[model samples]
Target chain A: MPFSLLNLKALMPEIFLVIVASVMVLLDRAVREKAFFFWMALVGTVVAWLLARESLDLHFGASYLSDHYGFFFKTIFLLVLFLTILISPGYAKREGFHFGEYYGLLFFAVCGMMLMASGTDLLVIYLGLELMSLSIYVLVAMAAGDPRSIEGSLKYFLLGSLASAFLVMGLAVLYGKTGKIVLSELAGWLTSDKAVLTGILFFIVAFGFKVAMVPFHMWAPDAYEGAPTPVTAFMSVAAKAAGFAALGRIFLLAFYPAYAYWVKLLIPFAVLTMFVGNILAVVQTNIKRMLAYSSVAHAGYILLGIVSGTKEGLSASMLYLLIYAFMNIGAFATVVLMQREGRVGESIFDYQGLAKLYPVPAFLMLLFMFSLTGIPPTAGFIGKFYLFRSVVHAGYPIIAILAVLASVIAAYPYLRIVMLMYMREPEREIKLAPSPYIWLALGLSALGVITIGIYPGSLLTSVLASVF
Target chain B: MEKVLFGYLALAILLSALFAIFSRNVVRSVLWLLVLFLHQSVLFLTLQAEFLAAIQIIVYAGAVLVLFLFVVYLINLREEIRLPKFLGSYPLAFIAVLSMLILAVAGLVGFVPAKTVGSLSPGAILKVGHTQILGEHLFREHILAFEIAGVLLLVAVLGAVVLVRRLREGEL
Candidate 1:
């Protein structure tokens, strides 16, 4: 193959991420300032977003499509990355972990996610998954002073390696069956034989682990609680988005024929994930652990869309991911800002009387909580509505009903946070410094949540057009 | 001769894979992985997939395994730590392994009878099905994916650099 600059242009987003991550790592050593790293990562993410947007004009054939679906998810990933970087400075300063390496690792991870979003080949997708997972393991262990972080890192590493092995084995089986590894070829092969069905099941299992569906979710709470707040936020939103993106492509293309076989399997797991996640969250005192369970519930909702087995279902999943990115990141940003003297207060009691002590953050946290609970006038509500509607449309009314029940159960914990913040008296006086970057992120996310809730038609139309 | 050679290679691969998974020592496991990788490359060669065989050697056996070995050495697994008594249920592990072996053997027994042994001249195999042919197909049919793989590799390289970058005190 003759390498051309034109070919490089096709990889603008990826190139941008790589360059930014490289520069960030180099500048971390040269600058000796933490704030600079944060701003650099933020700017890098924005630049990558712009490059990703530009690449939409150059969509190729089935083997490498860069359509609206990829761009939409990439945009969501970039937004999540920006918010994570925005809230990171405070957490990094407090935890004494403000290194350029941190931001660089994040950039590379995001780059991997974007690649996964656009990938049309199984090999490319696998490579992207590995890239993302490898960086995340390092990020989880980056907090050197915390034993919990090390433990979390080790656990995540072990489970993630197992998941990778499963995924690679699935790929091997699929390739052996079809003598092809490209998505287009696999789609064609799906129509021919039933043996590929087993391979597809293995792929779905791998994705289930990545998304923390019920039986595969044991590692999530510990990992979420142990990692720094910003990293947790990044993992919950960006990592989940990448996993869903890859899973969506595989289901919609390679495993379309086997949907009948697996949708039944997924429905039960989705129900269990939602039920267990919400019930567990209700008992959690640690804010991070609660959010972890909430994330598991959100994964369940996303899986509900996958079970719908229609273009509409896939579109709803994508829309839900956008809203999830905002809500999860905003929630974590508040957590990061709430830290005092290099330590985050994770217990629900730490938030007692916060409404009076820190009104802005308190209010923002309330908005995020409401959004997560899927209340009206929030993105979460709209996301859930679309997801349920799609599932019902696919003749899964019982599943839709169960989902609503789960959401109602889930809302109790989200509202509990709000009640603790606004309705309770202060145990002690607290001093809070408001960071402008975090405020910006919170405001944007809140606005996004509200706007999408009010008028979701446009986003829905775009999502439907992309998926179909 | 070709069939015998291929059978020997397949046996080597299966044996090495079993050793890699079941070995007590990490170093021995890595060695078994190296052996399996080498056997895989030979299988690629038998199929006249010279480019893939070369890639198997250079990328998997050479670069990736070397990196794995380096990390293993850096960690310096002390016997006390590495040989810690099995904390999980050994009986369960044994049962799982047994079930896996049974399933694998059953699947192979079912598949081997249906396999077609295609015969071609050595000249035809080398000339039409070598590195050049693979390159042509990769460049022509799968060009976009090929480019994407390049970008992915570059990102990984950059990511590794970022992960290992040093941080000074008070410098986030």
Candidate 2:
């Protein structure tokens, strides 16, 4: 491979993150105060973000690209990572698990997600996925003494490793059948190969596992509920977005010629994922578990766009994923704020009379809840509109209607939170440990959600234009 | 001679794999696994892949077996071996295994290696040497993957440290 200066410059964000994370890893051992590492992590993320902003336009190499599509997802990952770090220290402090590895692992996970977004080769994408998955496995298990955390982490590890196995197996089959590695070049050989067609099943199940589609979604809620709150927030947004990013690129680029076949395979999964996620979310009392199921449902909606197999559908999914990062981080930020002295404070009943006490966060949670349920005046509605419109435009009116129904069913859980916060009497006096950084993140997220909800025209046009 | 050696290696591998899975004693299973690894390395040797054969023996037989022996030695052996014996999923496992075995047999029966055209042929490997060819591929076309693997391993090390965090506290 020609190791070009241009390629390294294109990868400046990833390189910057590696250096920063390594420094922090060394500094973490020497630094006595966890707060010091936290500040270092924040500084590193800011520097990485600046590098990422410049790196977006630097495109080359046979394996990876630095185009608008990757750039869009990278920005979302960095924003989510920044917010996750901001919201993390408070909960880590409460859990007595505040340390350097948490932030270092988180940053590395962000790097992995960025790589996944940018990689064009199947090998690069797979390696990126593993790197990200490994970091998250460690981060999920970071709360050592907590059995829930360990259990969640273990479950995630087993299922995640299996998912990776499926992906590798599929990629191997594709390579064996077609002898091509780069996704763009595979389409010509892949269109005529039967074994490569079989390989497509592995890709579906593998990506489905990553995005938590229904049959493969069993591990998600346990992992989500049991993980540390900040990690939960990060995984629900950035990690899920990473899954869709790979899915969109691989299926769109490599399998575009075979779209008709994959679309048929994807439609039922979209419906099942949405229905199961929403219906199961209804009975969940824990906030994290509810969000896990809700995230699954959102993944289903995003898949609705991919299933259409058109640029319009693809653009719609891209736009929805960006909007999702803001709303999810907003909700989880409130969940972080609701934490008491010792616990993560995840039970829905914990939010009773929340409006009377922490009115600002309570109101923000309401906005997030509304956005999540596709109510107007929040970003989720506009996202849902474009996604379903594209699906219907692609001639799948029934799936769109079923999606509308699933969102309607999904409203119950979000509204239930709203009810507990606003209408119900206080079950007990809940003490909140407020972190200023978390508040800033929550404010920014709420602003993002509302601003995009109302004026999505410019962003929508750009997303549509740049997707090719 | 190569065919005869391949036959012996394949038989040894199959038997050892079966014994490794079915053996009740944990140490016995590890010994069977060692046999499987040895046979695999010999198969590679027969294929003229000397580098792979050497690495396979060194890594799998030497280093990995030592680690496995250490873990089996440290843990409660009898209790670990006696805990469970394929309880509920036996029938389902049987069905799945049978179908997969049939599929494997059919696939092998139908297998035909695709003939390469102007690519890395055996003559090319004999001339250029396997290690150099492997290095060229790794450093050239797959360099990005090579670098990413380093990142993956670094993450794993960090992960191991994280997992072992409360080891001093008797949590493990």
RMSD of each: 3.9, 3.0
* Best model per DockQ: 2
lDDT of 1: 0.80
DockQ of 1: 0.26
A1-468 per-residue lDDT for model 2 (tens digits):
335543678888998888888887877668887799888888888888888888876754678888888888888898899889889887887676677777888888988998899898999999999989999988888666678888889888988998998899788777766667888888766563455555787799898999999878978998998788899999999999999989999999998878877777788899999999999999999999999999999999999989988899999999999899999999999888887654547899999999998788789999999999999989999999999999999999999899999999999999999999999888787777788998899998999999999999999999998785
Instruction: Report the Cα lDDT for residue A246, model 1.
Output: 86
lDDT, candidate 1, A1-468, per-residue tens: 243333446578887887878787777658966788787787788888888888884644434557777888888889898888878887777667687778888888887887788888887788788778878887887766677786787788788888888788778777766567777667765632344555665676688888888878877998898888889999999999999998888887777877788787688998999999999999999899999999999999998888998999999999999999888888987787776754446777788899987887888899889989999888899999999999999999999999999999998999998998999998965666468888888888888878888899988898888873
The top-ranked prediction according to lDDT is 2
DockQ of 2: 0.43
TM-score of 1: 0.87
DockQ values of all predictions: 0.26, 0.43
Please identify model 1 stretches exceeding 4 Å from their true place.
Answer: A1-8, A60-62, A192-194, A341-343, A428-433, B1-26, B34-127, B138-172
lDDT (C-alpha) at residue B16 in model 1: 97
